[model samples]
Structures are given as C-alpha cells and as structure tokens.
Target: MFLNHSREVLRLLTSLQADLLILEENELLFFNYFFSFLSSVLGLSITIWIWMLNKKQNRRKDRIYKQLSGTNALLIIWVILMIISRFGSILPIVLFGTPGYDNHLNLYEEYWILFVLIPIVVFMQSWFTVRLVYQAGRWIFSTFLLCMLTAFVLQLTTTVSQEKLNLAYHQRFERDYNYIDQEIRIAKEKYGIDYSEQTVEILKKQVTESSVKQVESVKKAFFGDRPVTLDTIILQKIIIRNYKEGGRYYYKRNAIENWRYALPIDILKQLSYFDQNAKETKELLEVLKEMIDLVNTPEIHWQEYQNFTETERRRSLGARYNIPDPLIEQLKKVQTRLLEDDLYSDFFKNLQAIKDRE
Candidate 1:
C-alpha cells in the first residue's frame, strides 16, 4: 500500500513537472517548478529511506534514532532555506505592487506556498507511516483528516485569488473602453458628423476590439511569459515613468488623434456613394488621402486672424506651404460634392472647422 501510494505521488509530480516544462519559455516559472520538484523528490526519498530503517529489527531503536537525527538536521536546514525564500519572494511585491524589475522573485512568490507545502506533506506522511506501524487506526484517521483540511484551505485560497483576478480584469476592460469612448465623443462634437446607425455600429465594434487587444497586452506584460530584451526593458521604464509623472494623458491624446484620422477615412468612403463618376471618385479619394496627411502635419497650423473664415485660413496655410494649385483644385471638387449631399454636408463643414482650429 505504501509503495502504491508513493508511485501515485511520483506519477502526479512527474505529470506536473512535464506540464511546467512545456511552459519553459517562461524561465522564472520553469526554474521554480524545477527546484520545487527536486525538493519534493528529495523529501520523498528521505521518507522512504526512514521508513525502511523503521522496518529493520536489528538495533531498531538505535538505528531509527540515528536516521531520524540526520533527517531532523536536514529538515531544520530546509526550514531555514524556506524561510529565506519566502521572505525574498514577498518583499518585492510589497515594495513595487506588481512584477516590475524583480520578476524572478515575484514568480517565486506566486509558488512559494507550493514549495513550503511539499516538504511539510512529506514529513507528515513519514511521521504518520511510522505511527501506523503501532497505532494503525488512529494514524490513518488523523492522516485523512489532515489531508482534507489542507485541501480545503488550498481550495479556499485559490477561489479568493481567482475572484480578485477576475474583478481586476473587468475593471481594466471598462477603463480602457471608457477612454476610447471619450475620444469618439470628442470627435462627434468637433466633426458634427451624425453617424448613421451602420457607421456607429462599425465604430463600436472597432473600438471594442482595439480596447480588448490593448487590455490583453497589459495583462501579458503583468503575468504572461516575459522575454528579456533591452528594448522592452527600456520601454517598460518609460511607461512606468510616464505614469508616475501624470503623463498618461499623452496616451489619451494619441488615441484621440488615431480615431480622428480613422473617422474621416471611413466617413469619406461611405459618402463616396453619392458620386457616380468612378474616375472622378478615384481621383477624389486619392486627393482626400493627400489632404488628410497634409493637414495632420505639424507645419500646417492655421494662423489666427481677427475675422478669418475657415476657407480663408485653409488657403493661407496652403500658400504658406506652397501647396500646388492642382491639389487645391482637386480638394475644392471634393468639398463641393460633399456639400451637395445633405446628410454629410455638416460633416465636411465641421471638418473644415477642425482644420481652421488646427
């Protein structure tokens, strides 16, 4: 029965080690799993040897005492090491909040309980096995009760940790989506573009997808397989510094610009349905693309005037940059077609207003 139980434990441990090895890309987890497995195997071997010594009849008490003395000495040294490991694992999280520079230590903290549990379980099993030789029923009941209690504690801890993790994930998702929605709202106010139902749906879908990807990226940085690279490390430091200095608004502004650029392209493409001349439409699309790029450039800033109209500001900036006459003529053609469509006339009008402000 003892041998069968040992075989089962070995099998389970082997399976777990194999599963962990498959995640070897995560070097920190790999090493933690390796060391924990090594310690468990060592502990189990020592227990088996002690059990064998107990079974010997010749010089039984003396032999058992000598063997147990050595085991106790080893256990004391292991306990000291475990304490140090546990302390090292927790100190970084208390200081940094998350896995920052000392990811190895953080990973150890994640599994340190497992490391502590393995040796303890082994020692308890050894004690119970020896006791069973004399008080079989009592030792058996005690071992079963201890196992149940240990399992219950472990399950409770896991459940609470999982609930906390889920809550955090949802909060992050909501926060990111809110940021994206704010940019969209600003765009709507500036452009006066009464988005059609279809267009609104498209924008929502795209924004949701983008937000999910962004959140996933953050999750990966926190808890995924981290590869060490100089560029990545530098980027992480920059991001952390930015957050500390309240420069996170920079990301919000960047998102605003990205959506600002994307919205016009999509709206313009949809409005192309109003123009039937395929050739002119193609040319108009090309010119619109060029105009969007030109207007977005830093050099295209509108000069303030006491009573400058939107068209006047555009022409002045165009001349200042020495924009070609042909490009200007093509843009005027686009403006005329856009204004002819009652549904999107306000879109082009507000678009010009944005250019004037820029």
Candidate 2:
C-alpha cells in the first residue's frame, strides 16, 4: 500500500513538471511573436511619420520649408531607415537576450513590408505630392525620372566592365604563364641564357602538371576543390618551382634570402609532396617537420609547476625558474645542423657570392 502511494506521488510530480515546461515554452514563443510584431509596427509608423513631416514642411509658405526638394526628402527617409536597421536589434539583444526563432522571418519577411513596401509607397506618395503641391509640369517630372534611370544604368555598366577587364588582365598576363615569362626574362637579362619557344612550352607544361597535381592533392586531403584565392595559387606555384628545381633554387633565385626565414607553415603543409625516400629531399623535409612541431609545442607547461605568488618566486629559485623551454633547445640544435650541413651551407655561400658579384 505504501509503495503504491509513493509511485502515485512521483507520477503526479512528473506530470506537473512537464506542464510547467510546456507553459514556459509557449510563453517564450508568444513573447517572440509579440516583440516581432511590435518592432515591425514601430518601423512602419516611424517611416510614415517621416513622410508626413516632410510633406508638411514642403507645404509651408516659409521659404526654408518650401525649398525642401523631393531629393532632400528622399535622403532624409533613407538616413532614418539605415539607422533603424543598423541599431534596432542591438538594444533588444542587450536587454532581452536572444530573439525568437521567428526573428529571421520577422526580419526577412515581416520587415520587408516595413523597409521595402512602405518606403516604395512613401516614395511614390512624396513624388506625386511634390508634383501636385508644387504644381510642377508632368513633362518635366517624366524627363527627370528618365534622366536619373539612364545615369544609374550607365554607372552600373561602367563598374561591371572595369571589373571584367581587371579579371581578364589577371588571368591572361599576371598569373600562371607570366611567372615563367618573368623567370625567362631574368635568366636572359642576367645570365644571357635564352630559352627557345620549345623550352618555354615544356616549362609551361611542367607547371600545368604540377599545379593540377597539387590541386588534386589538396582536394583529396580537404574534401573540397582548390580555394579560389590568389595567395593559394601563388603558394602552389612557389611549391612547384621549389620541388622541380630543387629546394635550393628558391633560396638562390627567389627573393627569400635565408632558408631558415622561409615560411615553415607553407613548407610543412607541402611536406607530403617531398619524397622522404629520396636522399636529396629528406633532410629539408625533416628540418621543416621539426620546425612545424616546435612552432605548435608550448614554450612552458604551467600545470607542471606549483601555483605561487610573484613574491614567492622572487625569494625562491625553484623548479619554475629552472625549467628550460624544449622548443628553444630543439631550435638551437636545428640551427646548428643547418649551418654545418653542406646541402644548405654550400648553396647559401654560392648565393652570397653571386649577390656580391651583382
């Protein structure tokens, strides 16, 4: 009998809790709809009030108010709309937390009635009101509207044409083939090494193959197509040239003066392309892999040390003060290896010699 009574009490409590939750949810939903409706109404009212005020001022016999043109009225309404749209949601979020799920619908659908439809209606109203109130000729008004539309179309066309021309220029003469051309030009001018058309064609083919391979590799790893960005394309080109001509070519021919100073992140990212089985490529890749690891490795492990005040640290030379960063230690060893290794040292010396002669 006592067990049956306890079970009944538990079921009642659960049912009451569920009812409370449902009530709270319904209240939240109601508030959301109410706020959205209120906001929409407020925006529409403000727009209509502005239109009315502009009309009243323009109708005044006083020269100051009479001088208010239709363009000036339109500009005023535009400024008001911009301000409201920009700042309307900020106050609500600060005071009432996040808006309802329907807030987007309110913004996109309900607010369109306020922002687009009302403004358009206001604009047409102002247009006809100005004409009627001022007793302006219909022919003059029609000509003014036609002229504005024509100027807007012309400006849009010019902007679009300029953008297309810039895109074409970048594609044809500045991106892929142009890098090879510049390399050829530099060799011809500096070393008197003239490449024939056949040589150029071969170089272009090699670059195309390298670029396609790199793009595919990236897509396979990331599960996406190559990102349409100039920096990504340029980095891939640099990697291709570095791989084909040997890593030393970048240090010798490219503006990068030191192998150590080259972007470790870029080298680490492209490390998979360098064959670790090959003797020539192994050392550079190994060094770059170490550098990337060191970059990500923390300088200090704070959790290893006991928590102590600044004053405590000043008095005691303990484990905290004695701890040496592993990254710094590893970096020193890598630097020594780079300086001593013939693969890097000899190439750098030759580059320095060439620069000295130049």
Clashes of 2: 0
lDDT of 2 by residue, 1-358 (tens): 2222332233233222121001134333333333333333333334433644554443345334333444445554566556654444342333212211112223433444454444344345445444534554774456445534543443333221123333443343234366667756855675455767754543443223333344344323322232223223333333333222211223332222222222433433343344444432443444344333323333233563355432233223212222124433444455445447654454333221111101
Q: Model 1: runs farther than 4 Å from truth?
A: 1-125, 128-137, 150-267, 273-343, 351-358
Which 10-residue window of candidate 1 scores lowest in summed lDDT? 239-248
What are the lDDT scores of the predictions, listed in order?
A: 0.39, 0.37
- How much is the lDDT of residue 106 in candidate 2? 36
- In every candidate, how many clashes are there? 0, 0
Prediction RMSDs, each to the true structure: 17.3, 23.3
